[model samples]
Each structure stands twice: as structure tokens, then as C-alpha cells.
Target: MTDTVLEIKNLEASYGSVQALRGVSLSIQEGTIATILGANGAGKTTILKCISGIVDPRKGSIHYLGRAIGGKRADLIVRMGIAHVPEGRQVFPLLSVRENLWLGAYTRTSRVEALEDLEAVYRYFPILKDREKQEAGKLSGGQQQMLAIGRAMMARPSVLLMDEPSLGLSPKLTEEIFTIIRRINRDWGTTILLVEQNASIALQTASHGYVLESGRIVMEGPCEKLFQDEGVQEFYLGQKEETGVERRRWKKTRKWA
Candidate 1:
């Protein structure tokens, strides 16, 4: 049986007085991709932050490989093999692409492994290699996203938490990013927890899914079932399931039918 790589119980977090996560709990199995679906301010990003130690949970337990990790330092989490590709592709604008990638390996003690990982990242995103010397700000949006993922990969993480990776990209670029995401998971046996607003793509990409609303988990199931859920179809998937009357009306109005 595949082991649970990360687990959370009753996770809660907030900003000032505003609660962002309310008893949020989930688990990701080894070598699988799990996605959280929600709208903006639904606390999707906050969950990722809590996992990667960017935001400390107010009340909860976060476990990685059966060890508690909540409230740890962010850099310590990275060193513990959890790398976060945050929302908005926060690459250092003034730094060279190579420089930004190297920063991901700051916790590693071995220079040789870091070099090898850099080459591996280059292989994953050859565009980054081509733009190695270029300032990160000079690259296009898609390239910058690639750079962000590559930087995270430099940490050689066991679990990768990706937040809105498809955000701000064209359809083609989004597809490209997800393709690489799948490849990373497949090739490296990486357990991934993806947080996304694009429900359609997120459903397609992940094996298991959770739906968050108002800082709480509203639903969860296998991706296939979640994709077919009426609420999910209507709200998240942008699909309106027609009632019998509506279907009849639609059929009646279709001259070609």
C-alpha cells in the first residue's frame, strides 16, 4: 500500500482576526497528486502556506512522513524536503535565472548534488537553460513560471506544494506547466498537493480532490466523482447541468435537432 506522505488534522489558520482556514484537514499519498479546489479567498493558498510553514496554523497538526512539522521555520520545511511553488510565480526580478534557481538549494550541504539537480531542472525546462544568464524579469510570463517550478525542483523535494500554477497564463502555457508538473511527479515519484482555482484542469490533473469554501472543506472525493458532482459541475467546472424542463426547451429550440 502507498504510504501517506503528508497528513493534517484540524488545521486552522488566520490573518489578524480574520480566519483563513477552519479545521482544514487532508492527506496526500506517496507518489500521487492531490488538488484543493476553491475560489479566491477560500483559503486555498493559506493551506499551502500552512503546509510549507509560511503561515503557522492556529490549531492543528501537520505531519510529514509521520513527523510533526507545523509551526516550523519555512527554510527548515524546505530542508525537510517540502518545497513550495507559491502563487504568482514569485521569481526574483533582478536576479539571473541561474541565481534564482541556486537560491533553492541554500539548505543543501552538498554542492555536487545541487549541481546535478540544476542540470536536471535544466532538462525539465530547457528554456531556462537558454535564458540562464538573463535576468528573471526579462523572461516571459510562461518562462518565469517555468523558472519558479525549476527553482522549487532545485530543492529536490519529496513533496511539492503548488499554488495556482496555472494562474496568469494562457491556455497553452497552462497546459505546458501542468505537463511538466505531471512529468515531475512521474519521474521523481514526487507527492504533490496542488492548490488551484481552475477546477477543470485541476480535476483532470489530480487523482484525489478537496473542495474548500469559506475556510472549510465542503466536499472531497476521487477526482472523477468530484468532476461529476452537480455542485462542482455548476460552480467550479463552469458547467450548468440542465434540468429536464431546460433540456426539453433546449432541444425544442435547436432547429438542427
Candidate 2:
């Protein structure tokens, strides 16, 4: 039997009057990577924020490791073994690389264990090791992304929530990051819930996928199945060879649900 490590059911959230998530529900199995694919403003980031307790859900339940964690504080959620690597690589620019990574272990009780985790992060990102004393802002965009991910790992989380890890990155850098993400899941046994606009890479890296549109889950299935789907091929993967007219016609007739 597949063990579900995280589950979000009928989740609803909003920013003031603007509703961001409308009953979004999904589950991630233990020790696997799950990807959420969507366009901008589709509430993909909102889901991760809700899970990480950065945004409070107005309704629904969030379960991690069979425990209810809805409405918990963000720091409390992190201490409960979930770490969120937020969008836009929000590393503290003024802090040194080592200092930024050390902050991820704020919830940890043992200093020795935190130090060991820091070494593990360095192993995954050797560039970070070389720049340990340098200010985080001095690094390039890709290096900052590496630091963001490494800092998350320093938390020693069982479940990692990553939002738009490929945003603003070159293709080569994006590939490298995804490769490291796969390695993190495979080698460290950490379950990941990844939100990405790069649908092709997300589908390829994850074992299962969910498609979100306008604050709701529109479709979901195994990654291979989603990759081969005609609509997904056209809308997400750019695999459709049809002319513009045919594309419009298909959209007019297609039912997203």
C-alpha cells in the first residue's frame, strides 16, 4: 500500500476579498515527488503557502503524517518536519551563505545534528561550500536558488514544499536544479510537493501530477499519463503541431474538467 505523507482536502483560502484557492485537494505519497502545474494566478503558490501555514485556509483540512496541522503557525509547521522553499529564492541577501543555511535549523534541538545537516547541504551544493563566507546577495541567480534549496534541507524536513524553483532561471540551470531535486528525494527519502510553471520539467521529474486552473484542481493523474494527454501536450508541453485556427477550435470544444 502506498503511504500518504501529506493530504490537502477541500482547501479554501483568500487574500481579503480575492479568493485564491477554491476547494483544492491533493495528496502526496511518502518518499516520492509530486508536482503541481499551472499558469500564473492559478493558485499554485497559494496551495503551498496554505500547506506551509504562511497563509491560513478559510476552510478544509491539511494533514501531514496523519496529523491535522491546519491553522498552525508557520514556525510550528516547520518544526513539525515540513520546510517550504518559497518563490523567488527569498534568501537573506545581507547574510552570508553559511548564516542563511544555519537559520533553517532554528527549530532543531541538537546543535551537532544541525551541523551535520549543514554538511549534507554543502555536499548537495558544493558551490555553496565555496561561498560559505560570502554574502548571499553576491551570488548569481542560480547560486541563490541553490542556497535556497540547501537552506530548506538544513531544516531536516521529511516533506519539502518548493514553489517555482525554475522561475527566471536559464534552461541549463533549471535542469541542474531539477536533477538535484530528484537526487534529494531519492537519496534523502524526502517527499516533495513541487509547484512549477515549467510543466514539461515538472511532469518529467515527478511520479504524479496535478493540474490547477483558476484556483481549483482541473486534472490529475500519473505523470506519464498526463505527459501523453492531448490537451496537456497542446496547452502545457507545446507539442501540438496544429495551426492557430485549429488550436482555437480545439479550445472552444474541449472541456477542461
Candidate 3:
């Protein structure tokens, strides 16, 4: 197996006349977490969409496991070993949790394989197991997000693309979600490319990081080192220019059920 999981060269994507990604290129190594941090409209989600084959890039190439995957259909990319957990945690509201999870592996070769995938998901999130027959719409936001991730896992993706998995969750639930993400990468060796608004935890958890502003990469480096950077402090770390590290931790309450 190759150490390099994903590579993009001079990638360009646009929505009509408005360009979102402008000649952006990056690499993700196997079994590592790569995070892209940017404000809204900075083309973070657009990049993932292009990688997952939902959006066609106007220029450049995307290589996954050493094969060109750009411009393919979304389902084709899913079968090619990339699973996407979109920003909204867009689970099927009317369906039961189990049914929604089942939909994730509709292209699996056999029922036995799908069952095994279900077992893997249950192991990662026992909470979903308890709510198997419950309506997905009735679940809390955090539970729904967990279901989204579990559904993605059913695809058995080599690379997981997550967009704003922390959105609309309390600080406590956010922490829990990020913890599970880190555990997933550590235990399963799943290469994850994450885009998050919560830069504090996102930067802390990722192995490598890229800072995007207005669709351009301003800085890129390892997470721990970037944690101490002045730009990361002023922007991501959520500190004032004059304020030193207060050694304060984000308060996480009891919320993940």
C-alpha cells in the first residue's frame, strides 16, 4: 500500500463566474488526520465536494490511492473508497436509524459484508445500537451527527471527508464528536480530511493543518506547532493580539447521550 492517500495538484473549482478554490493543492498521508480551517465561503466544503466527486473541478487532478478520481460521479467515488459525511449531518429524517445506515452500503457486494459493516459501526457507536429502530428525525442533533458518521463508516472508506461535524452542537457534544473522530482515526487507521469551524479543537486533534482565507492557503504546518502561531491565536485559537495563552480550556458540559 502506498503511504500517500490523496494528492491534488493546482486544483481549481468555480460556481459560475465565482471561483471557490483557486489553484489549491495539498497532500494527505495514509492514517493521518488532515484539517482545513477557513471561515464560511472560503471553499472548504467545496474542496471536499470535489474530492468526493460531487463537484467537478474546472482544473487540476485529484489522485486517490494513486488513481485519478476527479470528475467521477459521487457514487463512483464512494465505491472507490472515499466516504463523505457532509456538513449538515443529512440523515434521512423519516427513516429509522438502522435503515439510514443500511442505505450507506447499498453497493456492497453481499449481505454478509453489510452486516459486518453494521457490526463495525455499532462497535464504534454503541449509542446508535440502542436507538436502532428509532426515527432518525426524532433524534437529537448530536445523535444525528453520530448517525451520519456511522453511515459513512458503513462504506468502509479508506479516506473519510467530514465537513463541520461540530456544527449546531453544544461544547460538550462537540468535544465528544471530536474525541470519537480522533479515536476513529487512531483505532481504524482511517485517513480523515476534516473541515471544521471550531479551530481550537480541530487544530488540536489534527496531525497536519492548512489555513485557508478567501479560498487561498495562507499557512500550512503541523497542528501542535500551529497551535502556538500568532495568526492561529488571533484567528483560530480565539485570542486577542495582546493576550497570551491563558491556559484556559473550553468548558465541556454533560450532553452527549
* Top candidate (lDDT): 2
lDDT of 2 at 33: 96
In candidate 2, which residue pairs get closer than 3 Å at backbone N, Cα or C atoms, i.e. clash?
none
Model 3: residues with Cα > 4 Å off, grouped in runs: 243-257
TM-score of each predicted structure versus truth: 0.94, 0.96, 0.92
TM-score of 1: 0.94
> Lowest lDDT 10-mer window, candidate 1?
248-257
Q: Report the error of model 1 at residue 55, Å.
A: 1.0
Q: How many backbone clashes does candidate 3 have?
A: 0
Rank list by TM-score: 2, 1, 3
Tens digit per residue, CA lDDT, model 1, 195-238: 99999999999999999998988898999999888778867888
Please give the CA lDDT of all the candidate structures: 0.92, 0.93, 0.90
Q: Return the TM-score for candidate 3, rounded to 2 decimals.
A: 0.92
- In the predicted model 1, the residue pairs found to clash are none
Evaluate model 2: give its TM-score: 0.96
Colliding pairs, model 3:
none
**What tens digits encode model 3's per-residue C-alpha lDDT throughout 19-57?**
999988899999999999988998999999999998999
lDDT of 3 at 66: 90
